[model samples]
Target: MTLQNQSGTSTIRPTIDTMDLEEIVELRTSHMVVGGAALARDANGRVVFVSGALPDELVMVRMVTAKKDFATAEVVSVTEPSASRVEPACEAWHRGCGGCDWQHIAPAAQVAMKTDMVREALSRTARVDQPVVVTGAAIAPWGYRTTVRLAVGDDGRVGFRSRRSHDVVALRACPVADERINGLLATVVAAGTDELSLRVGVAGAELIAWGAPGALVSGLADTVRIGATAVVHEDVAGHRFRVSATSFFQSSPEAAELLVAAVTRAAAGLDLGQCTVIDAYGGVGLFAATVARGAERVVLVEASASACADARHNLRGQRAEVMEMRLEAWTPIAADLVIADPARNGLDKSAAARLVQTGASRIVLVSCDAGSLARDTRLLREHGYAHRGTEVLDVFPNTSHVETVTRFDRFAPGDRANHPDHV
Candidate 1:
């Protein structure tokens, strides 16, 4: 049947009832998408997504699946290459190793693409036309990831999962992972477990073996344990954070500091000496601890017990208070500012409404997903908050994930004086 695409192009599409399911097609890639797929238009004007190909390149693709308007393919060969394309740093790049998708793209080009993606998301989704301010690319893109979880296959191969598949690709080392983490791969393989995690910091490396007996633990790192649980200490900005296997911590120490600095800059101009601040979804109190020096009273709201405990430990001598509850369950306290760094899902809808109810004059939202950031930005806009500005940080280099810090100011003036019920 003939169809018109979003780009105002007319073409023919084969029906599922009559189309040759095993047909191969040639695709000239146009651009990259989230999750590292190179998007191209097929002969019939239908979208085709293929991996291991760069934009402005001609690739022979083996169609794996076909849908009504689009198809998914795997690159069989690259007939042409882009100037920004480079040989993948990892030998496992084309082997379906899903760890680093943009490893084939130049580091500078990757950062530029991420910046454009964030800016486009804000412009198209959040209705913000302002140019996004992006931080410079990482000085050391390779060997910067402080933590990584390696999946173990049934055959005892330790590596990462395949892109959009359950298949595990074995690896000797990951270029994006820290050298210390790569150094423990041998120990992880010896643990004889289904999965394992390695975390490295100033204190040293810690290994967490999943579904393995505690007896498997040895001198792989300074601290090693089994049962998929253990806390690793990370020193950031003069503060120490005890991060567990499940707790969230920035993978790159340098980028984490940059994020904290962005948060601090966005939260400036408040009466920090006497004003109260809330760190919503404050995993391990990264923001709370960093901003606590200026905040007279800081309340950290986290749902993870382990993360809350870590926050409590991290903020022991500071003036911050830890609340071990979800943002939706925690009672709203009047404050001068609220800083939320939620997961990829962004803020809960109910809790976002409640955040508006808190009547904080300033709110800083730090997010990893641009789509969620845009969604939550619109939610706050509907509640009478003005989007001041945003700064994008290239924390996760060589990947589509982008981190953004957006500040919003409430339009309706609220009382800045201390309230008796305010924490």
Candidate 2:
């Protein structure tokens, strides 16, 4: 079957009978695929990929491309909804801004799905049978995001890209944005001339608007500082943080507090008090200072020189040694605990292997991307570390991204004999 769009583009449509007969398979082992939602297999037994559908959803899909080994389809309908499915909160999500995913799933279900994805990635990719627990977010799902970037449309209106395409999607307001940002958006949109992009930051219900040329517009109260440390806010974890427009800090203060607490708790069981500790990818030293409270000596490894300078200011009085070097080049000293909160890429193979080689008694990995976490965890397990446990933190709500804290203990072949069921 074939369906044509208004633009005269043709798409192959899958038969309803075939969709109804296809077996249910889990996408990324998190989302279930059923009915027309599942891609049809050719006579050669190669599976196809379907979009805009969820698990248990009976969709009548239109195949857009069919290669020799695989195919791609677009969903037409869903006869049944997955138990986890829910109405998407953001109407602009389907337009493909690349900002949020999993908006159609319930918040609780999203967390659970992320937890399962982490566990499966560990077991299959890392070959560890470790148990995982999911945790709730620190703040409300909607209106919790404090920062957002929007592309300026050709029509002089700021908008976001469509869900899966570069085409701009017109948006009057963003639901996930804080009310303060929305208010600022109104003013910006009203006074717009031809700005290519707009970046807004919200702090405690006050909005600070920055134009494409990096000039402040309005809605800021005053610059808050702690001693020489100057930021939009002074208080973070009972200490002052020197934050700026470019400096990386967690947008949600509430969520940041919860995440910091979780990381602190995860490190409590490990004896970092007397041993040297390395906080790799330590941005602004938020976690470094928190973890340093317990560690006798802490070494923060960062690649960004500017962030390291900020770290120096943030950790002025704290007993921490800052090393401005990449994680790959920096030599690893044996430590009690190593906390790594890397970017979305997680840890490269070299860094992951190096951490294992350091022989750190315990490793706490904080990741925003589950797939990368799973891949790194598997790498660690292969290098003689036993997965202790994993906890999912819903840092970014109303979106598919999840923060996870995974603990690992260095293991020897005969060590498990003393402690059975360790893995």
Candidate 3:
């Protein structure tokens, strides 16, 4: 069958009775897209997003999802491979482990692809023409994840849920997680819980796990701690943060440090010493205790009560306020600068509008999703804020998740001194 590809060239595809009858199709991929998929076109000229594939590679994929305009597939076989492709560190990845999507790509190439994704999102979605240069930070490819959430299968297997489905992929060892975490993977399989969260801190020596309050973890190591109220203290950017079982931290201390550095650089010009900073969605006081610690008053707004409890303890001695409420509903307070590290969904219009109501002179947005970052920045722009710049950190190695720290300045006539939007 002849098909029109993204290159606008005629290509031959396998002629099948129907996608229902023959789920597999051969296609050559074009460029990398968000969510660790490569863009391609199938026989019917419908856009095909293929996972477990790389840019400019010809691969046979099995279609799992079908829509009128697009389809999603997972690579079945690679007829032609790219040089950047490498063996995944974790053997479980080949078994459909959903932890790391880009484990097949070389580390350096992964960083480049993340940068490309961020730049394309800003340019295409946000319509920003100001360079949109994304800075990619290098990180270790394996054995760096300090925190992991394991799903328990009905057959008493422990591992991660497969992408596009809830089916768990049982694993013998997880190479991407910290070595200590891998040590406990087997012990937690029989913990009598459907879900488990594991974490290691204190230079990878302290191990903490959380499951049901009365989990059967007697088989776990003596050094390992587990319970519903369990918490881990992580040291990042020269400050120790108490992270509760419910609070979210970076995958590793190194990832947290890189993010802190990038955010500090994005807010470099602000006089933090005299400014009042608002750490929106501040989990466990990461920014309140590090990047914005120098500010006169730091307000950390988070909806998680458990996280707020940890933040209260972590932000000790600093002039900080812990408000346990969603940022979208929090009353706008006076703050010179706002550092919003929103979750994957990014800042919605209501939240963005509320954030702008703070009358903050500068806004630094830390986003983990490229598309959401683009939409949020565009919303802020519509609220009379000029996009200053964006810096991306590829801390989550071997994954398509891109961490972006963006800066914006409020714009208004006759407010050159307070709001330097022109600068």
Ranking by lDDT: 3, 1, 2
lDDT per residue (tens digit) for residues 1-423 in model 2: 565522245755343335433433222111422211233443235565666565445455555655566666665555556777777767667556556655766766666555665666666566665555555454677886666666656654566666567776766667777676565555454124233233233333233434444332333334411111223443557766665544566756666777788777777766666777778888879888776666778889888776788889888776898888888988888777888989988999888876766678788888887678777877776676666777877777766566888777777677865232453
RMSD of 1: 5.6
Q: Candidate 2: where is the Cα deviation over 4 Å?
A: 1-50, 64-74, 94-98, 133-138, 189-206, 209-231, 234-236, 416-423
What order do you get sorting by TM-score, best first? 3, 1, 2
User: After superposing candidate 3, which stretches have Cα over 4 Å from the reference?
Assistant: 1-21, 413-423
lDDT per residue for candidate 1 within 181-271, as digits (tens), equals 7777655553456666667654545545444554243445545554545667776777777877678889766877888888888888887
What CA RMSD would candidate 2 show? 6.8
Off by more than 4 A, model 1: 1-22, 130-139, 190-193, 204-229, 413-423
Clashing pairs in 1: none
How does each model score on TM-score? 0.85, 0.78, 0.91
The C-alpha local distance difference test score for the whole of candidate 1 amounts to 0.75
- The local distance difference test score of each candidate is 0.75, 0.63, 0.83
Top candidate on lDDT is: 3
Residue range 1-423, candidate 3, lDDT tens digits: 567643467876554325562467678898887777998887656788989899999897888777777888888888889999988867777777887888899988887888788888887788887535677586797888888888878876679998657899987678888888888886665557887778888553678887766656544787787765777778888898887777899988889999899888888888899999999999899988999988999999999999999999999999999999998789989889999999999999889988999999889999999899889978998887877778878888888988888888887866665342333
Clashing pairs in 3: none
Candidate 3 versus truth, CA RMSD in Å, comes to: 3.2
